[model samples]
Target: MTLATLALTWRHLPAAPPCPRPRVRTSEAVLLSVATLALLLGISQTTTWGWVDPRTLGLFAVGGLAMAGWVWLTLRHDEPLIDLRSAFRGAAAAPNITALLAGAGMYMGLTLLMVLVQVDTPSGWGLGQPVAVAGLMLVPYSAMSVLGSRISLWVGARISPGRVLPIGCALYLASTVQLALGHDHVWQALLSMALAGLGSGSTFATLPVLLVRAVPAGETSSALAFNQVLRYIGFSVGSAVGVTVLGLVSGPVPDEHGFVAAMAVNAGVWVLAIGVVVRAIAAR
Candidate 1:
């Protein structure tokens, strides 16, 4: 796949139009990288090291400081890694914030679904399915997401892309609620995945469109890249937090309550995302 991509790009990609070279913001880049890595590391290790451990606290502090430095430098620099001023404007900020929360919710749902099925039935909440079956359960999610993406395009054309966001978030919220309420039956799990996929598909597809429309043409790529970064950060944090919550609630084997708690958290995040997007649209 990598070679094919390379070959395709080499053969078919167009040359860039001549333009002045953009200056590299090396310090800002380094600070941003350090901040993201440190925060992710701190979150992931909290399950092993205990939240109060010196190492965990140190990482958190380092991440916070690095983030603060990055922001300060970005504000002062003529050509920073990211344009904080423009990015923070209502138009761009809404989609970015939505992406972060939606990403977290998406990962949390996936993790919980995978874990829920493989857990032994003896736990009184799991499906006791084999790993293969557990894996297959995600098929609906993948398939429905494609459909959802199409649906978002259709709906966006009729209404507006910004409005489409809340609809997607609402679907995700419903899926989480459904999963939280019932996951005992295999069909229930499958249904939840379907809904989640649809929601994710629509939400993810809409975010980029909204972001690009929000930013200047020259800054479009950078803005989109930053949104992706936030999304992945949310993914990392969500997966880690889901696992930690499960472990805390159900020990080595996850139980129904753990899944419920995780889903509840996921649902809460979606609710917040919906609110943010709606408010942004209203303000616009």
Candidate 2:
């Protein structure tokens, strides 16, 4: 199926016209890479190194300084790696911000759900399911996300493309709330995944469109790439935070309360994304 899809895409998709290659901003790229790596390391290792440990704090400080340097160099350079100024203006800014929040929320929910499923039933709220069963649970989410993508396109054509993001965020929010309130039953988890998939598809699909429309043709690739970077950072942060919260609440084995707390945080993130999306639309 994957091969066939790839073949079809290769055969049908139009080749992009060649454009002049921009000069590589080596320093900016290095700084950004250093910052991303340091921050992610610090976040992911919090459980092991402890938050206030010098190693963790050192990583955070390095990441922050690198990020600051990247911004400063970017602002001064005529042809920087990414056009931060243009990317943060108007509609473009909305999708980037939404991507960060939504990405974090989505990842947090997914990580928590996986852990919740595999947890031993003796924990009172756990399902004690095997890894295979837990993996199968994501099938609905994967299938529904494709359907949601198509649905968003249909809805966008009929109404406004801008509205699709908020709608998607609402669905994601609903799924998080559902998970927070109940997950004792397998059916409930499946339902939540389905809803989350739809929301993810809708928002993910719409973000690119909004971004493309907002940026100049020449900067499309860079803008999209930057948005993806933000999304990934959000994902890393979300997963780390979710695990941290669960660990903090309950030692090695997380309980119902821990799961609930993580989901609640995820839900709040989605709410914030929705508000940002709505505000962006209103501003326009």
| Model 1 weakest 10-residue run by lDDT | 116-125
Candidate 1, 1-284: lDDT as tens digits: 99999999999999789999898778888999999999989987887887889999999999999999999999997777789898878689998989889989899889888888888757477888999999998899999999999999888888879999999999989999998998888999999999999999999999998988888788888899999989988887888788888888877777777778878888898999999998998898
Off by over 4 Å in 2: 1-19, 121-123
* Model 1, backbone clash pairs (residues 3+ apart or across chains), number: 0
Superposed on all Cα atoms, the candidates' RMSDs to the truth, in angstroms, are 2.1, 2.2
lDDT score of residue 110 within candidate 1: 90
The reply for model 1, stretches above 4 Å from the true place, is 1-14, 121-123, 249-253
Candidate 1 local distance difference test against the native? 0.89
TM-score, predicted candidate 1 vs. hidden true structure:
0.91
Best by lDDT: 2
